[model samples]
Target: MQDFSQARNQVLQQIQHACDLAHRTDVAKLLAVSKTHDADTVRAMYDVGQRSFGENYLQEACHKIDELKDLEIQWHFIGHVQRNKTKLIAAHFSWVHGVDRLIIAQRLSEQRGHELPPLNICIQVNIDAQDSKDGCAPEDVIAMVEKIQQLPHIQLRGLMVIPAPNHTQAFFDAQALFKKVALAYPTLQSWDTLSMGMSGDLLPAIQAGSTLVRIGTALFGARDYSQDR
Candidate 1:
């Protein structure tokens, strides 16, 4: 088995360094993106103190969740929210990081189990407005946020963004939008997270006030997608 302790610690140190450089006291938390990795790899990562994991593939993630049920891990569904999968996603994951549509949010709210605590979610924003991305346009976010906040079973946390590569300005744009929405809805007590950044752009995202960074490669090494074929 690959030793993950060093990689995890290195990433943590980089986060702290970025925070220091940005003069940010509230350091961004890391969300290890565990998509395509097996259950045992996740368990090993858990053993090294990674409590939060994000997955993109629903079936694959559910299998890992079942296999690792004994561990107290906070599973996050970080991919595009599909309507048919909301019920299972609502029941199984602790956080949904890519909610962009009101209908999707409504379904998640309605399907969440009463026994479970309010589902935590982040609205995905296409800061750069890339046609290929799966997020709401920046201008439409406030309206979506207004409707989503009224959902009874889901807590609207904040925005999740995947800006264009090397576009530091997009990170700042996302941060501005995040603050704008937060101010628009001050009553949302859980509106604190700004889930942005990944392995390549962690520093700029942190500097722009990201509260959560989804890291995969730096923590888990390069993923082999060939197995999926």
Candidate 2:
């Protein structure tokens, strides 16, 4: 069996260290990016006190969700939300971190079962300005936020970005960008999470005000895409 305890400790220790260096406490959170991991692996992490998990693919995540119904898991859909998948994404995930379009926000708000709590949302911003990236352009966030706020069954939490890995200058730029948007949205909801960091840049991301870090390889070892396929 994989030694997940060590991995979990390593990740928590990093978060603590980063929080200390930043002189900020109780701000950041670790969202274990459990994409491509089986339900058994997810349950293992759950056994060790990891509650929030992020998943990319919708179908696999739904399967895992069904299998682990007994556990109180906060499933965050960190993947791009396709129009067709809104039904399942709306039904299963407690949070959606990649709501890049107003239509998606509308669809989710519309499809969400009224019995459930309002869906927490993070508008994905193209932090690195990569044309190939999956989020909305940085300039478009305010406009998107304005419309999404009017939608029911969904609350605007903040911004999420996938900056180019190890791109030092670009990372700082993303930090600045997130700070800008957050400052502009003083009334959005709560501590507007800057979900920008990953396994490679957790420290800097936390120091720059990343309330949530989406981690995968560091916690679960390398991904086995084939297993899910």
Candidate 3:
């Protein structure tokens, strides 16, 4: 077993270091991407002060959520959300970081229970993205925001991005796009989160004003992809 508390602290320290290097007073937060890890690992990390977590797969996340219902964890759905999974996501998740389509956003908005607070959402923007990636073309961000503003059950918080690996152009491109999206929507109270960093390139993302970084292996060590099958 890994020393989760130490790993969590190391990540947090890195976050602060990045913030310092960027000269940012308001430091970016760390969202531990715990998709393949079991619920007990999450629970242990939570006990050590890590609250926010990101999960990619729905079934696995749902199981983990149920098992750890007693913990005060903010679950972020960071997967390629399919239409059929909308209802469950809307009901269970507090934040969604991969909303790439208007139809899916509408489904999530419609299904979110009225009694629950509006689900916080981040529009996924494909920056120098692969053909297999699921994100709105950068040009469509304004239109997506307009559509989401009309919906009552979900609040358009900000944008999420998965920039192509080791591509300096992609990282800078994502940063520019984050600024564009931020400026496009002037009145959204929650229009602040820029979910654009992962373990490999968190520094650039943070320097570019990313408010949240979804770090996995850096915090939890290598993943067990076999269990995902």
Candidate 4:
């Protein structure tokens, strides 16, 4: 197993460099993307005092949440969440980063049953306009955010996006999209978290105004996709 302390330090260095170059807000939060990784790895990160983790699968997140119930970990749902899985995610995860539709938002709000705190949510935007991606189109993002605002069970925190891979134009694409949403949703006081960037291209995302970068391989080593599936 890799040393969490060393990994944490390395991740911090990357975050610091990004902040230094981009003049990013000092409050940018790092979410250790722990999807496909096992409980031991999560525990290893927790052992090193890391508390925030992001997951891509509902079932996998449920399993990890149950196993790590005793730890003070904040779970983030970062995948294409289905309506059927809303209940499970609503009950456990503190944040949902892939909420792109009003239906999913309403279901998540209703399923919470007044038992848990309002779910922190970010509207996912298809900044790259990739047909394969699951997010609201850039042109329609404002309307979506407005619809989600009516739901009281969920707190609209900010915007999230998954830009095209390995594209040199990612920075401009993400910045433009984020700026559009920020302008449209100016009334929403908490619309500040831009959950963009990933292990491969976080620096550009930061330069484009991302306050939260979902990093996996950089902190946990390359994922074995075969085992993940």
- What TM-score would every model get versus the actual structure? 0.98, 0.94, 0.96, 0.93
Q: Model 3, 1-229: lDDT tens per residue?
A: 7898899888888889989998999989899999889898899889889999999888899999999999889999999889999999999999998899999999999999999999999999887758988898988888888898789888888888887776657766766776776677666667888888889998878877789999999988899988643
- Native-to-model Cα distance after best TM-score fit, residue 216 in candidate 4, in Å: 0.7
Error of 3 at 146 (Å): 0.9
- Which residue runs does candidate 1 get wrong by more than 4 Å? none
Q: For model 1, what is the alpha-carbon lDDT of residue 99?
A: 94
Task: Give the best candidate by TM-score.
Answer: 1
Kindly list the per-residue Cα lDDT of model 1 for residues 117-139, writing each as its tens digit: 99999999999989889998999
Q: State the lDDT at 190 in candidate 4.
A: 74
For each of the candidates, the C-alpha root-mean-square deviation to the true structure, in angstroms, is: 0.9, 1.6, 1.3, 1.7
lDDT of 2 by residue, 156-225 (tens): 8888888777766665666777677667777765537778789999888887778899999999999886
lDDT of 4 by residue, 1-229 (tens): 5888898888878888988897755845799999889998999998987889999877777999999999999999999989888989889999999988889999988887586788999888787778899988777877887788889878888878887887647556667766777787677787778898888887877777778889898889877668544
Best of the candidates, lDDT: 1
Please report, in order, the local distance difference test score of every candidate based on alpha carbons: 0.94, 0.87, 0.87, 0.84
Q: What is the lDDT of residue 136 in candidate 1?
A: 89
Model 4 stretches with alpha carbons more than 4 Å out:
25-27, 227-229
The clash count of every prediction, one per candidate, is: 0, 0, 0, 0
